[model samples]
Target: MRVPILRQGPYLIASIQAAVTDEDLLHLGQEVVERVGQYRSRGVILDVTVLDVMDSFAARTLRDLARAVRLRGAETVIVGIQPEVAFSMVRLGLSLEGVGTALDLEDGLALLDQHVRRRGKGGR
Candidate 1:
């Protein structure tokens, strides 16, 4: 299934609504990167609120996606990682290094705003 991505001013918000396969993640990464360039987006907010399981592959995919977005001169913030999911990732050593994370969508947006400001980039 396709992940819905919404462009909010200088930010792109992608909310993962359910458990997704590796292929879905790959597609998501590619689509997010393309959209970042296409929209000249300054930031990306990935909301995985409904995601209950976070395996190593999923963690790695998300880390790579954030890196790719960074290369496009955009910042990526992953939000809504449930407490259980976070615990599992930590236990499994699945880290999303070099990527910012927040408690929720609102927090993610705020974090992105801070990043954009720090980089001297304009925001919405």
Candidate 2:
């Protein structure tokens, strides 16, 4: 299924409402990147609360998406990773190394805001 991306202020939020295939994840990455550039968004929040399983490709795609968004002058935060999924990911040694993660949508937005504020203060 195609993920829907919404623009909110300076951020783009993509909420994955169901399980996704590799193609769907790839499409999501492409769409998010394009939307970030199109909207000149300052950050992106990917809500994956509904996903029960995340494979290596999914993890890599998300990690890459975060990196790509960062290069476009935006930050990316992944939220809503269920506890079981997180544990599995850890057990599998899958890591979203440079990506920011939060407990939920609200926390994700706060994290993005924090980054922006820190950058502003540091003149970065």
TM values, all candidates = 0.95, 0.96
Residue-wise lDDT of candidate 1 within 1-124, one digit each (tens)? 8888999999999998686778988999999999999999999999999999988888999999999999999999999999999998999998999999999999999999988898885433
Count of clashing pairs, candidate 1: 0
RMSD of 2: 0.9
What C-alpha lDDT do the candidate models reach, one value each? 0.93, 0.94
lDDT of 2 by residue, 1-124 (tens): 8888998999999998676778988999999998898988999999999999987999999999999999999999999999999999999999999999999999999999999999889897
Steric clash pairs (candidate 1) = none
